[model samples]
Structures are given as structure tokens and as C-alpha cells.
Target: MEINFKGKRALVTGASKGIGRDLVIQLVKCGAEVVAVARSRELLENLKKEVPSIEIVPLDISDWKKTKEALNKQGPIDLLVNNAGLAILGPLTEVSEENVDELFSINVKSIINISQWMAKQLISRKAPGSIVNVSSQASMAGLENHSVYCATKGAVDAFTRAACTELGPHGIRINAVNPTVIMTAMGKIGWSDPKVAAPMMAKIPLKRFGEVHEVVDAILYLLSDKASMINGVCLPIDGGFTAT
Candidate 1:
């Protein structure tokens, strides 16, 4: 189905690269005004050079106070994508306290903060909106060395379900897309070795990692009116890996 976002205003975090960057470009192409947020000002500027119409917000969403202030200043947002995240991989027994804190700050806490802000904005305006939180397969199935990452995304899915009960009353929808290893710059680095990637690939029925656009298409659909009735779902874009 062709998804359209014309006349919509969207807020997308992690807009500097991977799935978030592509989402911004696609949203603009579909005639939505987009506010792109990321910590790397230089990368955001580069993205702006490519998509001149996008508005970039160079701030770390982990800082709850500043993130709230920045988001409050934006105009009415019809859609929100909580896409900013960090992954600190290590054996569970070897995980550091600092790493856990950093992971939760960005992956879990930032999402809650941003989602609350978006929900309140939509609520006060008496507007109906959609929120798509970018999550991961790690949340469902245990992956070696992904203990902290899994914990964060698991929190996101739980929050999505719980928040939907509150947001639904106001005609707002919230959902999450848990994607498998998409072949972005980071994904390539993480699974570059055939030995490392083979085991995971074997688990997927498709026998391959996902592409960035594949995940982007799913997010855009969830964000668009096409998914108006779809709420509080942790949809998997994992090539049936989780199903297995």
C-alpha cells in the first residue's frame, strides 16, 4: 500500500544516519514537514545539504531537561519516531555499570521522555497522532553480548503497550518496530565477519540481513494514516527470525 504523510508534521530522533536518516528523506518526499534530531551536528548538516527542507535539531535526547525544552518549542507534531539509540555489547557478566547507564539513558529513558512530550503535545491540541518507536529483535530473543541493549528495547516494548491504554482514549496511536540486523554502517561493522554473521543469518528464513529501506518502509506505514487502527504493537521486521 502507498503511504502518504501529506500535511503532517513529524519529529524523528537519530536522524543523522541509518534508518532515521532515510525516514526523514522519505517523509519529506511524501510532503511532511520534518524535525530531525541527532547529537552530531556535522552529520545533520550534511543530511540537510542533501534534503534542504528538513529542520535539524542538534541535541542529545539523553539530556531529559534540554530535550523536553527543545521538543516543546517545535510546532505541532503529528507523528513521532523515537529512533535514537546506543548499543554497548559485552557479556552479561562483564557489563559495566557505566555502560548500562549510558545505554538506558539513550535507549530507554530518552524514548520515554520524548514519547511523553509528543503525547502531551497531541493531547493538548486535541489532535490525533502516531508514534513509532524503533526497537530491536534483541528485546524478544536473547543475543550473546546484547544484555544491556536487550534490556533497553524490552523496556520500550513494555512502555509502548502500557502507554497505548492512555493514549488510545485521546485517539492517539503508539507502536514499535523491532528490526533485525539491518545492513547499515553500524550493522556492517557489528557483523562483518562471516563467522559472526552466519549463525544469525541461518536463523532467519530469508537467510540474510535486512536493508535500511526495508525497515524505513515499515516505519513510514506505521506513522501514516494507513495504520490508524494499529496501536501498541511490537511489529517485527526480522525476516521471521523471531518467529522461529
Candidate 2:
């Protein structure tokens, strides 16, 4: 289907690179006025050169106090994509307190804080809106070294479900997209070793990693009115990896 978000206002976190950057560009292509947010001002400025129409918000979403202020300044939005996350991979036993704290602070806490703010804004304005949190397939099942990352994403999944219940009456739809091994720069380096990636790919029926745009397509679908009835669902763009 041809999706057009003409005249919509969107707030996208983690908008500097990877899937987040792709979303900002694609959302603009669909005609939405997107506020691209990330910690890197330099990268965001370069992104602006490519899609100058998008508004750039240069702030770290993991900073609780500043994040609240930054988001509040945005006023109101029709679409919110919570794509900012930190992935620190290690075994559960070997995980340090710092690793756990930093990961949760960025991945879990940020989602709740922003979603709460957006939900309130939507309710106050008496308007309907959609929220798509970029989670991971690791949340569905454990990976070899993604213990903490998995935990945070799993929390994200649970939060999305409960948030939808409370916000449903307020005309806010909250959902998550869990994608596996997307072919971003990090993905390539992380999975470049055949020994490390072979077993993971074997599990996926398609035997290939997802492209960035495919995940972006899912995010846009959830944000669009086309997914009106799809609420609180953690849709997996895993190439059937989770099927087995």
C-alpha cells in the first residue's frame, strides 16, 4: 500500500544513525514533519543537509531531566518513534553493575519517560496518536551474549503492552517492532564473523539478515492510520526466525 503521512508531526529519537537515521529520512519522504533527535549534533547537522525539512533536536534521550525538558519543548506530536537504545553484549554472569545500569537507563527508562510524556500530551489535546518502540528479537528469545540487552527489550515489550491498556481509552496506540540482525553498520561488524553469525542465520528460515528499510517499513506501518487496530503488539520483522 502507498503510505502517505503528509502534514503529520513526528518525533523520532536516536535519529543520528542506523535504523533511526533511515526512519527520519523515510518519514520525510512520506511528507511528515519529523523532529530528528540524537546526541550527536554534528551527525544530525549532516543529516539535515540531506533532509533539510526535518527539525533536528540535538539532545541525549537517556538523560532523564534533559530528556523531559527536550520532549516537553516539542509541544505535541502525532507520531513518536522510540528508537534510541544501547546494546552492550555480555554473558549474564559476567555483567557488571555499570553495564546493567547504563543499558537500562538508556533502553528501558528512556522509553517509559518519553512515552509517558507523549501519552499525556495526546490526552490533553484530545487527539489520537501512535507510538512505535524499536525493540529487538533478542527480547523474544535469549541470544548467546545479549543477556542485558535482552532483559531491557523484554521490559520494553511488557511496558508497551501495559501502556496500550491505559492509553487505549485516550486514543493512543503503543506498539513495538522487534527486528533481528538488521544490516546496519553495527550489524555488519557484529555479525561479520561467519562462526558467530552462522548459527543465528541458520535459525532464520529466510537465511538472511533484515535490511534497514524493512524495519523502517514496519515502524511506518505502525505509525500510520492504516494500523489503527494494531495496538500493543510486538511485531517481529525477523524473517521467520522467531517462528521456529
Candidate 3:
């Protein structure tokens, strides 16, 4: 089905690269006015070069005050993608406090702050809107060395459900997309070693990492009218890994 988002306004975080970048492109292609947020000014500029219609907002989501101010100025967002996250791979005991703080700040806290801002705007206007938080399959099941990462995503999954319940009456739908290992530049850099990739692949029923487009497609579905009845849901795109 052709999902048309003509005249809709979308704010996508972490839009500099990976699945977030593809989301911005696809949203723009569907005729939505997309405000792409990222910390990399040069990459944002390049993305704007490629898709001149996309509005580039270069700000770190971890800066809650700045993010709130920016969203207030933008006003009446139709869709919000809380896609900004950080991954620190290590045992919980081995992980530094700094890394743990960064993970929660970016992945968990930022989502709450941004969604609160967006929720207020939507509630005040009574506007119909949707929120898609990019979580992970790790949230569904724990791994050997992903305790901190799993904790952060577990927060995301919980937040999505609770937020949906609170925001649903205001005509806002909140949901999350939980993806397994995706083949992105960051993934390549982090899991390039077979030692890391081998055990991960073995758990997947499909025995392969998901592509960027697969996750983007899921995000677009949840944001569009097609998923009008779908809310407070965590849809897993995990290549059947979570099934077991």
C-alpha cells in the first residue's frame, strides 16, 4: 500500500546516518515536511544537499533544555521519532559509570524529555499525532555483555506503553520498533570481529542481520494512517530471534 504523508510534519532524531537517515529520506519522499535532527552539522548539511526539502536541525537531544526550546519553536509536530541512542558493549561490572550515564541520558532520558514536549503541544492543540521510539530486541531478551544496553532499551519499551496509555486520549499514539542487529556503519565498526557477530547471528532464525530499509519501513508504517489502531505496541523486527 502506498502510504502518503502529504502535508504532515515529522521530527526525526538521529537523522545524520543509519536507519535514521533512511527514515528522513522515506518521509520526505512521501511528501512530509521533515525536520531532521542530529549533532553532526556537516552530515546534516550533506543530507540537506541530497534532499533539499529536508529541514536540518543540528542539536544534541541529550541537552534537554535546548531540545525543548527547539521543539517549542518548531510547534505542532505531527510525528516524532525518538531514534537517538548510544551503545556501550561490555559487562555491567566492566562498564564505566560515564558510559552508563551517557546511555541513559541519550536513550532513555532524552526520549522522555522530547516526548513530554511533543505531548504538551499535541494535547494543547488536540492534534492527531504519532511517536515511534527506536528500541532494540535486546530489550526483549538479555545478552551476555549487554546489560546496560538492555536496561536502557527496557526503559524505552516500558515508556512507550505507559506514554501511549496517557497520550492516547489526546489523539496521540505512541509505539516502539524493536530491531535486532542491523547492518549499519556503526554496527560494522562495533561488531566487525566475527567473535562478536558470530554468537549474535546464531540466535536469529533467519541467521542474518536486518537491513536499514526494513527498520525504516516499520517506522513509516507506525507513523502513517495505516497503523491508526496500533498503539502502545512494541513490534519486533528481529528476524525471528525474539521468537525463541
TM-score of each: 0.98, 0.98, 0.97
Question: What is the lDDT for 32 in model 2?
Answer: 95
Error of 3 at 165 (Å): 0.7
lDDT for each candidate structure: 0.94, 0.93, 0.93
| Residues 111-220, model 3: lDDT tens digits | 99999988988888879999999999989998888899999999999999999999999889999999998988987887789997999899999998999999999999
The residue-by-residue lDDT of candidate 2 on 119-189, one tens digit each, is: 88899999999999999999999888888999999999999999999999988999999999999998999
List ranges where model 2 is wrong by over 4 Å: none
Clashes of 2: 0
Model 1 misses residue 177 by how many Å? 0.3
| Local error of candidate 3 at residue 126 (angstroms) | 1.3
Native-referenced Cα lDDT, model 1: 0.94
Cα lDDT for residue 154, candidate 3: 99
Separate clash counts for every candidate: 0, 0, 0
lDDT of 1 by residue, 93-173 (tens): 998899999999999999999999998889999999999999999999999989889999999999999999999999999
Q: Is candidate 2 or candidate 3 better by TM-score?
A: 2
- Candidate 2 differs from the real structure by a C-alpha RMSD in angstroms, to one decimal, of 0.9
